[model samples]
Target: MHMEILPFTIAVPDAIIDDLHTRLTNTRWPEAELVDDWSQGAPLAYVQEVCEYWANGYDWRTRETALNRFDQFTTEIDGLDLHFIHQRSPHANATPLLLSHGWPGSIVEFHKVIEPLTDPTRFGGDAADAFHVVAPSLPGYGFSAKPTETGWGIDRIAGAFATLMSRLGYDKYVAQGGDWGAGITTALGALDPTHCQAIHVTLAMGARPKLDKELTPEMHHALERLQFYRDWDSGYSKQQATRPQTVGYGLVDSPSAQAAWIIEKFWAWTDNDGHPEDVLDRDEMLDNIMLYWINGNGASSARLYWESFGKGTRHVVTIPSGFAVFPKEISPPIREWVADSYTDIVRWQRYDKGGHFAAFEVPEVFVAEIRSMFRRYRPGF
Candidate 1:
């Protein structure tokens, strides 16, 4: 199959921006949440403030220029037009790395680490530690085409990503992801072990520890966090999995709704002190929100949950694997449990800070973790 890779740039029309402004101006807001905290979802005041700034203060051109600073391209893979950022390292022996973004995140999550990873010398690291980075917006997210049919589940998405790396002329590469991206990366390791040399994941699913046996302190904490997520943090997943279209109508039409939907996760999931802005910049948060808002991917992105979540057979990975356990991530698996599924566990590190969005929350730590894990397999440590 011939794949045509064409240079792509972010050029949202002025009319679209004008439309967004008008919609923001006319947003039909609801009464403020009865509670002061975020237990009831994003507060009315916070959402309105963010939306107002998005309309008048935020500059899309600046964000677009930042995105276009790197080389981006689009290609047809399995009947879907895939979009990716391909930045090659100056070092000839640089390893190829595929970085995948999860829900509520786009390629924007990797903006901070791309340069440091691709050109390590420029960031006070040796050129020998450089990597040829390929960060792709997952199917139905960002600029990638939404799946029109069923069956674009995690395994299928993993296969498509393998094909993408092969199409990019990389016969061997490492994969890294978190959230839904972690699920896809683990699937890649299982589906294409020969080509996918190793994988580093922040979220390790498919590793069910035996609860019947005595649990260690770490195991008990892991179970507690998992239970908490199942109880409170999984409402969005359930909604997306069952009725994405019903939710998409409001998200696609109202910018405020879209902002609240995504912003709430940033608050709940990230390691923040009272507000999301404590750990993440307000503009940076909005930059990510705009990716979903402009693409109108509210429904298409959510449909991924419906296709794969709780619907597929789990595959055990045999290839080398590394796990970075961030403190505040919703699902933090114990090393013993992760070893049950990922047979060849090479590296496992725990951090005191950072959360689910490690790339965005702690780029330096994230880069160091990636470099450290692959160094064992990259031929020269």
Candidate 2:
């Protein structure tokens, strides 16, 4: 029972918040290169407006208080400190589900789903489907102290999560994820075929078609789009996986740069249509950015690629899996391609909406999908 939580009463210092604003106010912006479209990535007008709001109006303490409203705690697992928010349902038999997030995301991703999933009565859903939610900031992200050791790859993180479940005394549980969260959930499916039971993923990079095999029409289209994207859309990942330190310099230095980098993804991937304001409220989005900034995990968050992909790669797969393919992620995988890797088919849904940050962009959609997937395993009469 090794549990410790930072006293929720703790408040962020005014100076730190002021410093963030000061840096944002003085951002040394590059000369705007006019592009015919947003093809250059992160439009100057949009970034300037966002950075201005972040500097003048964004509130960190309010966001921190909102985050601290949950019962956040830490426990030692496998020689590392794991930070997670543990919200138990009054339903004694409520199923346990672990949700993980990816880079540029934190526990903030699930903030919208918490109330609906915890107290269904408040949200017009059935109490029978309530979950004892365990959302963890991946090692080296958010409240979890950056790992001092290496080898904490996705598989290792999956194993650590299994320990977290067992430590919480959950004998059987379902897993859910988006982005790197999806990858970790897949890793969990692979590592705990006996106990993890099932998985739900948003960023199922494993959706790749079988190698050395001809691509189907859908998959061929997906492959072509992916190739085109790699040509233009993968600089961040390549840099993160190869030289995180250099990339870290920009994010670690300026709050505006960090906001621009992260919010651009929201604009690019969401239904924003060149205006993130259309899809996300500025403060709600900045709360997420604050989680990274206040925790000083921006660099370490980027280093996940360095730590995992840097050593090598894992193309291996195992166990039953489900995919919640959103419109804005990488190319959706046809089931035929999925079957080549994960032999067990549980469920797959191609959503009409949602992008990379599935939980935040569309909580109701994700919650409904989770309930649908878990019913296959939690068939309690």
Q: Give the winner by TM-score.
A: 1
Residue pairs with colliding backbones in model 2 are: none
Worst-scoring 10-residue span by lDDT in model 1: 372-381
Q: List candidate 1 segments past 4 Å from native.
A: 379-381
Query: Tell me, what's the RMSD of every candidate?
Result: 1.3, 2.5
Model 2 over residues 1-381: C-alpha lDDT tens digits?
A: 454444233266888788888888888888775885667777777788878888777767677778777777778887788889888876656778899998878888899987677666678878778888999889988778787877777878888899988888888888988778877888888778777878877665655556577766667756765776688777888988888778788888877777878886777667556677777788888887887777677678888898776353443456567877776676665777677666777788887787777788888988888878776666242
TM-score between candidate 1 and the true structure: 0.98
